[model samples]
Target chain A: MTREILAVALLAGFGLATGSVAAGPAEDLKVYQAYFEQHFPDFTPEDYTRGMYNFSQDKRAQYEAIMEFPPYEMAVEEGQELFATPFANGNSYSNCFENAGIGIAQTYPRFDAERGKVMTLGMAINDCRVQNGEEPLDVVKGPLVYIEAYMSEAARGKAIDITVPDDPRALAAYEEGKRIYFTRRGPRAFACYHCHWEAAGARIRGNELSPARGQAANFPAYRSKWGEMGSIQRRFKGCMEEFGAKPLKPGGEDMANLEYFHRRLSNGIPLNAPNNRF
Target chain B: MPYPMISKNVALAAVFTVMHVVTLPLMAQEGKGASAAATGNGPEAAVEQGKAKAIELCQGCHQFKGADQAGTVGPPLLAMKARFPDPAKLRALIYDAQKASKPYTMMPPFGRNGLVSEQDIEHIIAFLYTL
Candidate 1:
């Protein structure tokens, strides 16, 4: 075959294999270039361009002013203080866990075979509060959630070390979390992979798409676009909206499970909370 | 002494008159050319050349109507007039699209495009001002 025809046949074969059948490589590149040209009219191909991923100077100042202790660090402090401050029965939260070390907070949303259900760290904390004969702190409300943020912050230096307790219960929870991540429920019929995984490193409008693996490390980040301090759950809500999906309530089991999966995927990444993002 | 003084004064006045008469129309024509180009019309046809050039190079992304959705990849051109209200700055942006390096990636340098002439750039600037 002629060189031009051979090139066309090869492109067709590649497209057929990939399932992106509508456009060939040349046309796809054109569309990609056009998309970037239109969206990022000022973008230059330079090494320094990576710096744009960080928060702007003004946003950094705002985050420093507001998120003082980082969310989980403050949560841990509150949890500790609440542990000292007893309920009407004079029982403390320290009696619930085996070691009572805050570092154990990272391994959570594990399956409880005995209970035949998923158990998140937030639930574990609230369960501890209730087991001690005290009214449990609302997982979504009050200083407890912030204290959770604080605890997560305290465990920041520690790597995500979730051990799937070689049990069916834990496996079931992990499977459920994976199901939630891939299931298409939104009006747009887009799964998380549609934007995060399949389109990873692709440009949408003017922004670079972030890899989902590192996503868990930047939770409780200060999103400048929202103009408020928020957690990973809050960012998830925004993503739901973008996908035309109903948002799950904060501190819900599903969100926790989703977080469990996301954190596990980010196994070794260090936490960079109260992070600033566009 | 009075006659000599009067002669010198006349000579000075005549020199000033000649200079003014010679240069005024030339300056006026240049001004008119620039104004006509800005208004999308000019005696030299630069404005017409610019409009054609814009259609060839920019219509792909800017889309003829300047609507944002028309070109989903780029911000709407209609909004640009509002965003860059100043004509001079807009002109500079078009002229140095490669240099501004804003968050958005700019159009390829015109020199690379091989279609844009200096006159074409001037004309495009003129056409843009009308928008």
Candidate 2:
């Protein structure tokens, strides 16, 4: 065969082979952990859970002062109150999760072979509400962020430990999440990695970008820009629109899978949710 | 394997060629964007516009300040006056930088992919000239 045709044949064969060979979760975790460890050499794996403040010393100082009078503390108190209050059926979020749903944020966004999809903590809380005949809460703000903030606060210092089941569906969901994280789209054609990975420490106007590490640990975070509490899902939509791209639905499979993949990337980092930021 | 990310490396040769070829013919009569920077006295308005775009887009990679300091992605644009003094070459370079630089330069083809308009690129070049 000619050189050109031979090259095409080889590429096609390689593509087919790549499609068939799915890597295991442990392998994925190993590579992802080493990536952040190498990039942010200054911070320990747990330090990433500290969020943007984990970078510069000045930023850290500012973050500490802000934390001294954290604005998100009230939300946690309110969430605890809401968590215990019985619904019309006298059922609470406690019925849906183990250990009364306290300190379990690390084990969430898990692959459920029975559901054939991933299940995030927010989704589980909403499921409990629905089962109790209560209207489901929105994942963006209000009670959703409040409750997640409370759960994350309770689970603070719990190491993130998501497990990608051996099932093909679980692996496929992870691959899809990885694809979304890397795919460039919209008017700007900027992917998540474009800013977070390739240009992690660079400044955009007044805003300094954060690296993708330790992000999952401090979610349901407070941003002074918004003057209120928000979830990682909220930030994803904001980032997408900022790049002049349309965002996916808030609690859809895409969002959950993306969360799962990101959390896994920061695996073993302590969960320190409800953190305040700029 | 996870350091640089596999997704980034998935950029195939075919995709790059398709984008560069499709966007090259867009070259047309000059817009006011590039000239504003060269003239020096053109209203600071156009320069500001260009600066805004650069701050939003390119600053993530290329530092426009002294010695092209900061940033780890692309080379510094601090010396654009001598490096890419010609407007046409600058425009072409920004449009499909990877193609102009090499087959695998990590710079995104902002022009070819419509990430930034031609007028905007001229404005970015105008801002680059000031640096």
Candidate 3:
């Protein structure tokens, strides 16, 4: 009995030693999220995930009326068709991912331990295409967005459960993403943190800026501006373009890392993808 | 046949050359107002236009006075003379603020991306001098 007790203590110590190695987030993720909540004291945490729609009562009413028939339904139907169809090599996307790609959107933008990088769901889809001897779709729009839309619809209401493991590389990635979020880029020199974090509820060009927390949960949302389905990557590119900065490629390391940092903030929020928005 | 192909290539080159020559002077003429911004003493530009323009462009990120002073993103336009001793430096900073400050500043470059012209920046400086 004493030997067993000694062994258990050693095992517990080992576990703690390993856990401490990663050092966790440099800044508390909870504190970062709280910054947003503190800024908009009127808004409950739930209202922010839907973006600018819930910013004002008048706007919410207008958006709610619009939501009766979300504009991106056609894209969802088109995506369902595309997802069901087989690839050129007689293999389909089902062969690449688990559970035939249903409800898998919430688990993505995950850090692949072997590759030592974040793997966005969009990148995984493209990977399946390339592996099956087909040309990969562009990350921004068209087929990729369509497929993502369908996947997001499938994963609707699933809690965002992205795992940022306590690994040095993962911690480093989160740090890098945090830097990108806060650091200003190029001649149109404003960081995303300045607009989104500092000016969380401020209006810019008919749009109320949302806080960074929980915004990542709903991707492939139906944007009225686009008149179709759009993904997080497409929105990110648009933000950079507005500031006159050269936007990063969709599914690239920086974007995936950015998603990683974001998913941490909305760690358990239910996905409301295929969502309607202005 | 060879002569005809040569003439086609030459004509294409000539067209491009003409475009370059025509565009050069036009660009210089456009930059003429920008150079005058160095002095901030151009007779053609007016101060009132600048005051209105300052409220529209800068009010989003900076506080001016009682009127459009809601912005807290940037530093308040206070003690304008000491903060920027040289009016030209102020113009350069407004033109391309990233160059004037450290590696990371929240101030957006109104001048560099041509979002705001130098002449417009000149008017903004005039308005700021009042503060």
Candidate 4:
């Protein structure tokens, strides 16, 4: 009896020591959403799609006013034209996506079983270009941002519905992404969880840190600072630079996996992308 | 044309170049900390400087008891003299917080990053003690 009790105690201690709490995608979604909800009791999950604007009524009002005359309207038009243009091999971007890539942005950072890797929408766009005998666009910015902005606009109001398959590789990818979220790095020695999780809605200097929950729902947003539309990967690179860390490649495996886990956390939140932000 | 030999030679050159790039910064960083000792400031002057530095940098996240601007991001820094009786321990926490506490601390390693020097931290410690 004594020996059994000691063994159980040791196992429990080891589990806690290793920080090896088992968490699946569903559990992660629940925990992250619950955390944000607990922090911002007044906010609905949909409110997070606006990022920092959710924290301040003044900012939200400004954001809403800007939305009435969205700066990205012309970019979205350009993106639609780009999407419809034929490649040298006479294949349109429509040939490469389901439902002609109309309203499918919410299903991105998906586990691609055939490729044994995660596939972000930008990667899919590049794959389409390659398949259609056209040179791939820059994954981080420029025309790709406009194209993704167009797709994001189509996906607005759709609930984010990312899926992590039961395959071991898919699970592994998700696990890697979760690890990246929690791992501390760079000169600051901070993880994504520190600001987004522990200090969600807390003011850092003059800026309010956004909760990580529905941050993925809006992307390829038109940042007032950039004065242009940019993708989520571009934002990731910028944040990493602030952390004083060498950023992972845009559209690379690590970033794709990170987005997979991030978007999964935002499961069921309505997407509101191609939005303006200050 | 010996294509494989050329490729192998190029690979070797690339490897050497990467090694050179990786080591140069580290070599440069080794010589940094020697000049970071206390500047011979009076106790009152040091405290004033420390208060200014804390407001400029630390106040953004940490709320000091007497500070006008409050931030709720990190824990409120109060009762510092009681919490850190030893100034060295406090200095270590400011230098590399991840090393002192858990790995996921949001506190920037001010000393490690050269954001604050030893003299600056010493002054900051003086201000903390006042709290």
Ranking by TM-score: 4, 2, 3, 1
Using TM-score as the measure, the top candidate is 4
User: Where does candidate 3 stray beyond 4 Å?
Assistant: A1-23, B1-28, B31-44, B52-56, B62-105, B109-122, B129-131
- Candidate 2's displacement at residue A252, Å, is 1.2
Tens digits of per-residue lDDT, candidate 1, A86-193, equal 667776556665555456555555566677666666677677777767566655435555545655555655555545556666665655565576555443344564
Pairs clashing within candidate 3: none
Q: Candidate 3 chain B — worst ten consecutive residues by lDDT sum?
A: B1-10
TM-score, structure 2 vs. true: 0.78
Which is the winner by DockQ between candidate 2 and candidate 3? Answer: 2
Tally clashes: model 4. 0
DockQ top scorer: 4
The DockQ score of candidate 3 comes to 0.13
Clashes in each model (backbone N, CA, C under 3 Å)? Answer: 24, 0, 0, 0
Give the per-residue lDDT of model 1 (tens digit) for B36-114: 4443333235445556566656654465453232323234455445676654455445544434433113244453233
**lDDT (Cα, 0-100) at A129 in candidate 4:** 93
Compared with the true structure, what per-residue lDDT tens digits does model 2 show for residues A1-278? 33233222223233443366564568656655555566667887667766556556898898899889999999999999999989999888888879997889877788988789988888888888998899998988889789988888888888888888779899889877876776666755566765666456665444567778777778888889899999888888998887678997799999999988877777788887888878
* Docking quality tier of model 1: incorrect
Write the candidate numbers in order of decreasing lDDT: 4, 2, 3, 1
For candidate 4, lDDT tens digit of each residue in B1-131? 21112232233224334533554454346543222222224566556767877986788898886677767787888999998886767777887775666444577878878777655666688888899
Better candidate by lDDT, 2 or 4: 4
lDDT of each: 0.51, 0.71, 0.68, 0.76
